[model samples]
Target: MSEWVDVHFQALETCGKRARSAANMLTVEDVFQDSSAKKPADAAQASMFGDLSHSGALAGKVNDVWSALKEELGTGRSRLQGVEKAIDQVETNLRKATKAATV
Candidate 1:
C-alpha cells in the first residue's frame, strides 16, 4: 500500500524543485533599472512606434507586466512550499500506518 506513496513523494519532490526553479527565473531588477525610465522605454517605443513620446508611459506599461509576472512567480514559489509540506505529512502518515500494521 505504501509503495505508491513512496513514488508519489518522490514525484512531489521533483515537481517542487522545478517550481522553485521557475520562480527564481524572474526578479524586479531584471525588469527596470535605477536610471530614468525614458532611456529604457525609448528603445521599445522606437521599435513599436517610430519617434514616439518618451513620456515614460511605455516604461510604466513594461513595469506593470514585469510586476505581474513577479507576483505570479511568488505565488508559484509559495505553492511549491505547500507541496513540500504536504509530502512531509504524507510520509509521516505512511510511517505511522506501517508501524501500526506491524503491531
Candidate 2:
C-alpha cells in the first residue's frame, strides 16, 4: 500500500540523516586539542624535554580522535545496516502482497 511505502521511506530517510550527522561529527576536529610544538629548545636537555612532552601530548590527542571517529563510524554502520534490513523487509512484504493479489 502507499501508506506502507511511505512509512518505510520515512524510516529510511531518518536513518540516513542520523548516519550523516554522526559522520559529520566524526570528521570535525574542533573538540580535539592542537598538539603543535611550542618553541625551539636552547639546550640539549630542553630539546629532549620538549620532544617528549610534544610527542606525548600529540599521541594522546591522536588516540582520542581515533577512538571517537571509530565509535562514530561503528554507529553509522549499525544504523545503515538497520535501514537496509528494514528496506529489505518492506520489499519482501510488497512482493508477497503482489503475489497474493495475482493469485
Candidate 2 colliding pairs = none
Candidate 2 Cα outliers beyond 4 Å, as residue runs: 1-55
- Please tell me which predicted candidate would have the highest lDDT against the true structure: 1
lDDT score for candidate 1 against the true structure: 0.62
lDDT per residue, candidate 2, 1-103, as tens digits?
Answer: 4677668767756765665555454432433435464322331233344657576566566567766766776676666666656766766677688668868
lDDT string for model 1 (4-76, tens) is: 7678767766775665565454344543455455223333333464456874677568767766776876776
Cα lDDT, all candidates: 0.62, 0.58
Q: What RMSD value applies to candidate 2? A: 8.0
